[model samples]
Target: MTNTNIQILQFGTGNFLRAFFGSMVQDLNENGNNLNICIIQSTSSNSLQQLAAQDYKYNLLVAGFKDGQKIEQIREITCVKDGIRLPDEEEKFLNFAASSQLKWIISNVTEAGMVMKEEGPFEKFAESFAGRLTQWLYKRFQTIPQSETVVLPCELLPDNGKLLRNFILAHSINWNLSSEFLLWIEEKVLFLNSLVDRIVPGFPSHLDLKLKESDPFLVQAEPYALWAIEGPESVCSHLPFLSSDSEVILAGDISGFALRKVRILNASHTAMTGHGLLLGIQTVGEWINSSDREKFLLDIIDNEIIPTINLDRDELKKYANDVLDRFRNPFVSHKLSDISLNSIAKLKSRLLPIFMDYKVLIGYYPPNLSLCLISMLLFYLRTPEKIRDEQEIKLWFKNVSKSQSEIDVLKTALATWLDLEWNSSFENAFNKVRQ
Candidate 1:
């Protein structure tokens, strides 16, 4: 049974947070750790009302492979004692946050949720997620000035914790907050950089219609999970749940883990996804299950990306193998169209770094990466029914008609897309794929 006491005040009710962090809390609760959750919806658009209807209890369906064998498990998450929405739940949020037991503020409101250009008014909480967090922090500070509140941001952005701290500081400045409150935020609040990995594709609408009435808030996820946090000795001491599970990695320097996981795991998806769509593959499992595409991606990882990564080779391979296992899970139907959203930006962040590094380190571009780049261009040119990417990028692709030489267009477009000098290596390799 979950403890009624609110020890964790989570800021988002998304699939990732609910599965990654909330599920872990469920573990803590089941283990007699006694800590419970109070989750606040990051935005008004969130379906928090649906969550509340279920008495804050939801089912986390974990399905994936381990050691080449299938595994399936379901956990009833009772840790989330309260599912809160803004405007209506503002007073409740303030009251719950003021609790001295609330030591951790776990958030997964997406990367964009970290930004707050301007925090409008104090009376009217700024609509931005960042602003909303700032308001909560202020209220918490007012309630307990010396309390050490650890904020774990599960967003995929680099330096997520530090960046969020800066945003909160900026909000404080814009709002003309008291120096006392500012000092408390700086001195007591702990924003530890973190990297979280788990594929939690929530409440599949197709399955939702067929699901039994007993479980409406059913969340599906891969069995593999990780929560790597960089912080002080206190972070380890406060979170005893870290030791009981192999999923949590608490360290002073989490950058190496971040780089390894984000690049090898996330970048693989980014690089292969557009190509998979071109190959008529609908989901990640479809791509990973196909021997040809699997080999293609594994070659890209070993030959191209791994050489540049500073992490140990054996560790990288193990993580890559784990990623492959997760991608092969039959239950999670991760759509390419969903992955294609902001794909241009994702490619720039995930794959381009490897391209730049590999080109500089080896004096030549890897053909596999080049092929993936060209395939990305091909997807843009074809423009499947699922439309994603910025208007500028789409319009650029739209300008290059079918009549234009695809290799030439790939060269022209990829150069501008990457903001790099047009390399003959990419063009030469891409032309071979064209032929």
Candidate 2:
């Protein structure tokens, strides 16, 4: 397909986007939207070649329990017309950026991918995604100044679009770009914050023999999906997928949706990772099947997380139940180790706020949350080498002396790392868990 036909320039050719956004775009095309996608791969991966081999066509197996019944559906995604890896196909990447039909730029480069780096020479391919995007937008500004574009960031970070816009602007200023270009960006471009929810566990290797045909790019995901974009209603006109029967939501503010998902779905995952892994549980399904682990997870949500949120209690409870149901899906093997990536950062964003809020509301830290924190610390303490986090976080645990008592070490780590205040009730709860 031609570059002019590719309306969406997606950054990151990961499985989640393939199953989620790609599926949605495929649905849009089937329904007369006629939009196509050009995926941009930032990292060094053969995904582009794989897609090319399959003619940019792959199967998405959506399998899970819905409405008290098992549902399994498959769709061949044909929305992706082409793909180009950055720094390698730099010219082609920039050309797509300047496409007149390009209306939306969507990305899901992970939480760490949102960072801005100090790089230079706008003419050359930069090292960071934000920097490379800066060059892409600059190309677009020079080519089509009058054309408007919408940037939808699918990263789990809060205010993702705002953060990306800030990074792009910073890169522009750092590279000493023209004031006219910056003005065009501010006036014409829309960086919209969005929250995407879906559990894509990638290839369904368990069903290898049951498959109809071999597809290297096939992705498996749960039936539940949500794309909450914080933008004006007019955005629906630009992105007709929002008007479709899909789960995409256009809201004035997606904070409530984000809060509910992060606090319930994400927080539960993070809170259970260390504990579940410790008990030899491999996947989220295993954790949910275990009666004690299930109860412990529910306690963290219903007793601690729900009370901290200001949203309707019943809604939060229902959402929590839904999250649990998603976890119970037997088809997806959501690995605990995968969720354990950057555990410290996940804990900070997902559970730390609830911890602080619960403390203020009840005059003490919530026991369940405190126990979760302790369990995480203990997991780190026992498996420093196995844990995947920033060097500093790993070093903090590495520095902890084996000579130190578990209570003292945990308390010190809590105070120093998390800045959580120690209390008698927390101490008692920790002691009970130890026994």
Candidate 3:
């Protein structure tokens, strides 16, 4: 167990955090930082009890390209000090929040975790991750002094920290917190918006037997990783605990990073999920193994997506080529379904930009982007059928029914969301396929 008084509060224990953030923190501590980590599951039920009981110990497998060679490494991480359920262990979490030694906070609670309702500030007791974070921040404001919190949100959303801070502030208004507290939040807590890239395929437990037979020790990861954060100078100066390399950037404005990531990394990944699956390419390696898929991905990146983004084309092209090479990693078994988890939000943030830009610039919608939208619509409509929970499936079906016909609704929705026009050609292109 990491015994440092200075601690990090992590909001998720899934594989991505385990491999990326967890490993990074472990590296930070091993290199003389002595930082401990306390993990929290936002929900009331503590599903991570067993993992916590084991002292948050987990083995991470990293595979793919490194130094121009195929590399695979398995590492055990042991930096987590403890784990708890936020609602069930509220006192502990609040105590940690108020602790003088607590310096940094992190969360990767998915897109759904970003929502905050009109209830304003969190209640005396709340269960949602956002609610919990708000309450924790309030506790810190009430108790801690002389300094503030540094929050790095790793959720795959645009302006995530800004949105989260807004939710907390809104909650404060709803909860009738005082102006003093609000002022403190505005001044003390620094919410750094970040863009994190790592295709951690997670623990391949299902393929454990096969992996053992071949390599006895095998881990999975794309050969690429990047984390870019935009924050104040103070935050940048105090970021030695993160990493000692240039991979993590504390930029003046993250808009450029956001644009580059969304245009190349995210856009290509979403496009590949539908098309790759259709081509029977299950893993990223399989997708890369095929010249056709590789060429298609590259073509989309160069022709459709790149022209829409505002960055230097040559630089982005170099990075995009490197990203493509990472996709060809042999050991990582990244799944289309996993990447397709939040397709709706992914489309809204990543692919929608290219879709709208192509429409405006070229005065014609691209077929490939249209296909991605269709895949999302179909996924939203029919994917719910295979879900086992009747209530969940019913809710999804309800959403679909509330939506217009798949094609019509998707076309209009994308156009409105992207702030583009719904012209005849666009409608006809979208209408070619039925859900």
Candidate 4:
């Protein structure tokens, strides 16, 4: 019931969105844009309750290297006017969706959130994130058909916006909605495929004692951020933040940017996580500080990943070097376990493409990439309980007996789950690395 007009309806309340999108909107509002955000908790997390307790305002710490100089800035975020939890507050969410002032719908529900799961009846809130979005869009269509809304999905997946639109349409058809609704979505709605880059290590427990005030939801992130959105020039009109100093790119095609990020930044994280965790490394800073592990990661990026990408090699190298610097940021404590969430999905989206491309481009399977696969398998074998993934994926790892030898486990996991062929080279590499 705040008097501020909620022009943006966000789908997640995670640290990344608060630091990246929320901060950008705050900047826009400061520069004379009166737009405010209404955050909808996509999951059953207590973040909404906490955000509400604080009047939907929180502190964000941006600390990292920028232009080869160390920088740290803390700011209070006040762009969020209200917060609502899905299903529990479905009526409130739908009411906000019906608002004519709402022009943008943003989400950062991670890679797994894009999946379409089995949903119950439309009356009872659907389980999947996509299902809930489908319902919300339907409500909006019913209330304000003429009003156009832009959807910017910030998931790491390539072509995420199109994927989400298809999911919503599929859900609409499943719910037996009218053809007009689908056509309305097609004509009025704009789903812009976007790639967001930021490293937000949620709730800096290490800096709690140093903080000036008590905040249950303080989010810390690196200074570098890029939100490359693919859409026409007119789309910029809907987003007032583009006028600000934020690095928001409106390109005809963001595929190259997406590929570079996914293959370089995200793929390096996934490739390093298993090995880093096994080596008793806790934070990304620790992993990069270790000379041996750092070299291992750089080798995969320079030798295997960069060659597969069709972009300019020098540009890719510069980006890779910057990624290493970001990792070395002393202020951030990005946990590998956090990055390890849904590692299987991450592997497929971020690493598997590079793995295939390396074979095609390099004329052979990359040895370091092979070691990454084996390392992941070994990590999963050793730490099944700590793994957080889909139930099916977790169950698959749990069913893997500890009695089996490392080679057998690697062979079975690669062949069955990943559909990857194992060879003597991979076996030899695994043996050497494991020893």
Pick the winner on lDDT between candidates 1 and 2. Answer: 2
User: For candidate 3, lDDT tens digit of each residue in 1-435?
Assistant: 222374789888666776667777777767777777788786544457867665666666776777787766666677777886756777777777668878889898776566775443345676466677778888888777566788889987889889888888877777787899889988888888998888788756544444444332233555466788887676756576447332677777888888887778877887777555544456666776777767777778888888898788889888898878777665667877677665656666777767778879998877766665665555555556432222543365446554466656555545543455566655654565442
lDDT of 3 at 435: 28
The models' CA-based lDDT, in order, is 0.77, 0.84, 0.70, 0.84
On lDDT, the stronger of 1 and 3 is 1
Count of steric clashes across candidates, in order: 0, 0, 3, 0
Candidate maximizing TM-score: 4
What TM-score against the true fold does each predicted structure earn? 0.82, 0.88, 0.85, 0.94
Candidate 4 local lDDT, residue 75: 90
lDDT of 1: 0.77
lDDT (10s digit) by residue, model 2, range 1-435: 346788888988888899999889888778888888888887766878878887888899999987888988888899998888777888888777667888889998877677888896877789888998889889889888888998999988889999999999999999999999899999999999999999988888767535536787888999888999898887777667785455998999999999999888988888888667766677888888978878888888888989989999999999988898899888888888878877877777888888889879988877877777777877888788878776788998987888988888888887877777667866866776577
lDDT of 1 by residue, 1-435 (tens): 223377887877767777778778778767778887878885546578877878888888877776677877777888888767776766777676577877888887664455666655787867777787788889878877767888888877788899899888888888889998888887889888999988876765444333446776778878778888888776787666585453898888899888987788888887878778877787887778878888889998898989989889999998888788777777788777677766777777778888879989998877787777667768877774355765677777777666777666766777777775667767775675667
Superior by TM-score: candidate 3 or candidate 4: 4
- Clash pairs for candidate 3: 120-171, 121-171, 121-172
Question: What lDDT would candidate 4 get against the real structure?
Answer: 0.84
| Ten residues in sequence with the least summed lDDT for candidate 2 | 205-214
